[model samples]
Target chain A: MPKHILRLIILFVIVIGLFLVARQFLIPESFGEYGHYRANSIEENANHDIKYVDRAECAECHDDIAALKQGGPHKNINCQTCHGPGNLHIEDPTPENIVKETEREFCGRCHNKNAARAKLIKQIDINEHNIESKCIECHNPHEPWN
Target chain B: MELNKKNKKTRRDFLKLSSAIAGSVAFYSMFKPIESVANRKTDVTEREHWYGFGFDIEKCIGCGLCAKACKIENDVPREPFFFRTWVEQYTIKNGHIIKDENVIVESPNGGIDGFTQSVPDKEIFKSFFVPKTCNHCYKAPCVQVCPVGATFETPDGVVLVDDSYCVGCGYCIQACPYGARYLHPEKKTADKCTFCYHRLKKGLAPACVDVCPTGARMYGDLDDKEGPLVQFIKNHTCRVLKPHLNTKPKLFYNALNEEVR
Candidate 1:
């Protein structure tokens, strides 16, 4: 009824109208497509090239080594775990790219005596346990401690 | 008398106008956040993935390869304190009365390098490495407490943070019971392990899973009943960390030590 009241009502209506118009543009296209998030995120995450190749791929070529590793202490260990990522090597086999791990320090990374390690786990002090010989000389990584 | 009547009419109009403006302001303020809720986007999809993590305590040799791999993969700071994932070595002695014996828990440099024995050989009774990461709880406190919708759980059951959206309020960091989250030093946003969400989506095992010399850590789809993770969970006596909190952590630990928190 009042002039000022009419103006206020008109202003409020305008604000609401603007909000309704803007909201459509503000929200993402894929929002709420999957749960409460953007659906395209799935496709985005899947875009990266995989770096690590699993054991199944290694078994394709190295069946002998795979057979030796199975049922052994190191059965659970993947070939790439020690040899390093094989995606490049799988594409092109090369001694320079995919070589057997020969360094004693590589083995020492896990087997070296450490107080934090479980007591039952066989650990070498190196100084006390065959310091003269390399780990692979006495222990075959495929069937270690055999 | 006529002029006074006109003045009264103007005053009434002014009161009504002021009230209307006040009402509009209040209404706008109330609905603004709700509208933002509709706009708020999480970097997640409705994909059917039931991601789960399994840790083998007995298998862990405290070699820290998992931590190292996780750090390198996630670009976590190489510093000891800023760990996206870490391994804690727990050593306990004294059999029956465990409290009577010495119990030591140490994770030097987040166990990035293999740990050196702190206690002597004979003195120690039992020790094992517990690999730690974001539990990605079904009912995550971090998701609940985030001021913004920055941190959220994906349909695959992976909990992740949208660094772009995070306000760096640190609520998620504090809410995480497992201490999985930290305010990233440079990014200033809450950062935690996404179970290598990027890696998972790419059809590869997580970096930690790939690098673990011993099969101490495992990740797989929980929905796949025939999968190794489901089989492992079914076969083994598995326990999650801090079950009492009721976070419903997806990370299952086999042979979890009593001393481990």
Candidate 2:
């Protein structure tokens, strides 16, 4: 190929490549809206594995509290994130997953991260907060905004 | 028989022509977009899905019912910064800024009762409410400027964001001249009032439609003859928010007592 022709071909390819790479920066993720509002991927639990019921599932008995949670922000998040999942608790809503102290541990799992780069946040002194405070103190696990 | 010199062209001639083309290209790149924006017009020109809402400035009592209900339905954050929808209360006296109805804040519920006391100095003081929400412009600037198609007008004409798709870069947020869109804090996605599309799918009205204490906020198809908007337009000499821009916002404000001149 001629020298000028070869150089022209290389320049065209470079410009087109630039457009392609810049495109990724232009588009945002598609799965952000109504994210956890839909459903979570669940795996089967062994019979011995204990679980706590979803807030909505538990509403069959605790209607008042569940009703209040409906208006709160964290309404879509699974109960397991706070109380733990209820795959094994189909028969019983109460278990170690439903413990009163689980709130501190669950939030601590993320907030207690050593790095400041954490996007999600829940700040409570596990020792001090757990002694008296809990996750519900600032946020309702069932409803983050509430 | 005249021997013609080879056809001659000077370098200056070529340079001037090239410079003119380059200058035109440079100038065109800057102001051409304005013309393109003009010719592009808005999707509302088709009179299709521009969801124009009207708030009677006089009828609005400043009650924040719309905001509160929207927050619950869409889970909008109530913190100091982000706002999907808002209201601007204006009280104009002879086109003068009277009553300082400027809330300049994003509140779902403007906290006004939509009723004002009888002002004795009616000329000096008259109060009115104007609730602002996503205009759902036919040519949605948010959608156009969105680096991602995260914000788009649905086929039905209501503008919506596929939160699942939004990257929360806030390009749409900044592009909106009307400042309707915002990035959610936790979900980290762009969000705005959807006109409660989830309800519309069920053949029910939007949450704001259901909760507005007064019929201040109204929604209807601008194209349908049987739609209230058609009749509303026929009866009322209404004004659209910033119609000069020709965004063709579906949201129309009825009896907009005072719009920026």
Candidate 3:
């Protein structure tokens, strides 16, 4: 072989060897264990804390309220939907940890007159319907119709 | 002269043989059955879990509780533009034929606050709410476009992004046909719904499904033949968003109108 060609071949081999060595250090240990991603990432993502408690957990303690809600249109709504996340409250069992929204705007979120809202959902113009009073006073949140 | 000629002939033959051998080796390597690193590691037939999601458009009440619950559960950005999930209100104007111009779609605050009807009742012919989220496609464009291999699909068929590995080049965000991925403002990485994989791992429903005021949203294992998701699909003519895109979206919608995108 020509002297120049031999030198070129030697340089190419060294460059390729350096690249392979650098790749070993740069690439994650679990990079190819699963698909193209790092396998440990799956476990890291699954380790997130559970923030929202199931409704069945609430019903265990508040069966009376659950029974009241079951007989009404709100039966399908989860207790935590309006009350907010109850994971902490479930552990501590404190009334202050959970919300009890009684404001008209809170109820109006779903019920207030909106053209886009489903017709099946009974909507009212908040300003026109029983002005200057909370919705819970006239309409029970657990059983609004009754 | 004869000896010199014979030596030249031998040299030419050696060159030809060497060239032929090198060419064959290159051709063989090109067609070799090398294992694809991108393909799922698990055997599809033996997969213990393959999750799917479905929703009934008729059952959705436009209350936006599901949208609210998703934000609170997932810690998605409070900004209107950065949502892991959202609700869009579609209104078809009265006396107007269904067309791109006639249909009005709006999602204010990603419907975290309930929607207010923009189109007057007299002018509106029909309206419905469509809750949107990551479709978790079987052939995900986001996963395919992630140059760093940061985004991938799990064995259970949920697409997720590894924030640590992401360079945040925004290729995956742009590649998504469903407009599902968003760049996280704080993390500066591509973020989207994981199908609530963390919650799913703990044997719980996704936050949106958990808080739906009407039984509009549902989640179940596609592997389970008797699962509610399978039964619902069998019973109803469920449609996926942008079926022609060939994304193979796991999110199914029942009573999906022709007007919805």
Which is the leading candidate under DockQ? 3
Q: Give the best candidate by TM-score.
A: 3
Q: Residue-wise lDDT of candidate 1 within B1-261, one digit each (tens)?
A: 987776675777989999999999999999999977675543335346689999988888887777876775567887768888998988886556358347788889998876777788787787777999999999999989876567778777888877766779998888889999898899998888878777776677888888887677898888888999998899999999999999999999999977789
Model 2 segments beyond 4 Å from truth? Answer: A1-146, B1-51, B92-124, B259-261
Expressed as tens digits, the lDDT of each residue in A7-113 for candidate 2 is 99999999999999997675443322322111110110011122222235657766776767677754543333333334445565556535343455445533432
Model 3: iRMSD? 1.6
Model 1 B-chain TM: 0.81
Give the per-residue lDDT digits (tens) of candidate 2, residues B9-52: 57988999999999999998999778665654244454345445
- As a whole number from 0 to 100, the lDDT of residue B147 in candidate 3 is 94
B54-102, model 3: which lDDT tens digit per residue? 9988877777888888888889888888888888988888775646777
Worst 10 residues of 2 chain A by lDDT: A37-46
Q: Candidate 3 clashing pairs?
A: none
* Per-residue accuracy of model 1 over A52-108 as CA lDDT, tens digit each: 565689899889989999957888777766776676888897877774877666676
Per-model chain B TM-scores are 0.81, 0.70, 0.90
Model 1: docking quality category: acceptable
Candidate 1 residues lying further than 4 Å off, grouped into runs, are A58-75, A87-105, A114-121, A137-146, B1-47, B95-101, B224-226
TM-score of each: 0.77, 0.50, 0.90
Fnat across every predicted model, in order: 0.44, 0.00, 0.63
Interface RMSD of each: 3.9, 19.3, 1.6
